[model samples]
Target: MRLRVEFTTEPFDLDEAPAHAVVAREVIQSADLDAVDVGPFGNTAEGHADAVLAAVDALLRDSLGAGATRISLQVNVVAEGHK
Candidate 1:
């Protein structure tokens, strides 16, 4: 199964990236996922279910440990025909 995950770690910083945001980005970028898009307000990654789920686990743990007060996320199963 293919999965797509969209997430954000809160305690927003306009001047610079927060520690939690940085950690979240690092986790997603390093994970065995594809179609990763990282932005100031949000981030998304797509890959097989296992890879996406593993990344989600790491992202939550690392970002929270790095001082994220809140995290918003959504996971969806991508249809085979969809991109």
Candidate 2:
């Protein structure tokens, strides 16, 4: 299932930001799932559902670790036949 997910984590160390994105991309890729598109908007990622979810997990594990605080993650999945 494809979806569009927007999520953000607590402000991270400046140097670790790209690490976050990289980990996210890596997670999605590792999932061996479909990749329609992906990009960064502030701290959020906008793209495929499976990949985005994978990215979220990666970001949490890599950036925030187990102590990560909850922020806000919004997802707007384009309905089938709409995209």
Candidate 3:
């Protein structure tokens, strides 16, 4: 099954890339996920269920460790072509 994780870090400028955001991207990419999209408010990563979960966990840990005050995460693990 595939999963998607979206997250937003707070206490940092939403307009520019903060350290936490950078860490999130690096961690997600390092996990070798299928895809990761970064938007103005948050970022989204989609891939295998296990990878997504692990990446999300790493994202949270690293982001907070990188100085993120708070994080809003949304995780979806519905297989493709589902209603």
Q: For residues 4-80, could you state the per-residue lDDT of candidate 3 as single tens digits? A: 88888877685778898788878977886777788768788888888888888888899999998999988888678
Measured on C-alpha atoms, candidate 2 has an lDDT of: 0.53
lDDT tens digits, residue span 2-82, model 1: 999999999999999999999999999999988899999899999999999999999999999999999999999998655
What range of 10 consecutive residues in model 3 has the weakest lDDT sum?
74-83
Q: What order do you get sorting by lDDT, best first? A: 1, 3, 2
73: Cα error in model 1, Å: 0.1
Q: Which residue pairs come into collision in candidate 1? A: none
lDDT (tens digit, per residue) of candidate 2 on 1-83: 55665555554556554555555445545553443344454333345576667666665676555343553566667665544
Q: Cα deviation in Å at residue 17, candidate 3?
A: 2.0
Query: Which residue runs does candidate 1 get wrong by more than 4 Å?
Result: none
Error at 8, model 1, angstroms: 0.5
- Model 3 earns a TM-score of 0.84
Give the runs in model 3 whose Cα sits over 4 Å from its true position: 81-83
Candidate number achieving the greatest TM-score relative to the actual structure: 1
Q: What RMSD value applies to candidate 1?
A: 0.9
- Name the candidate, 1 or 2, with the larger lDDT value: 1
lDDT value for candidate 1? 0.95
TM-score of each model, paired residue for residue: 0.96, 0.46, 0.84
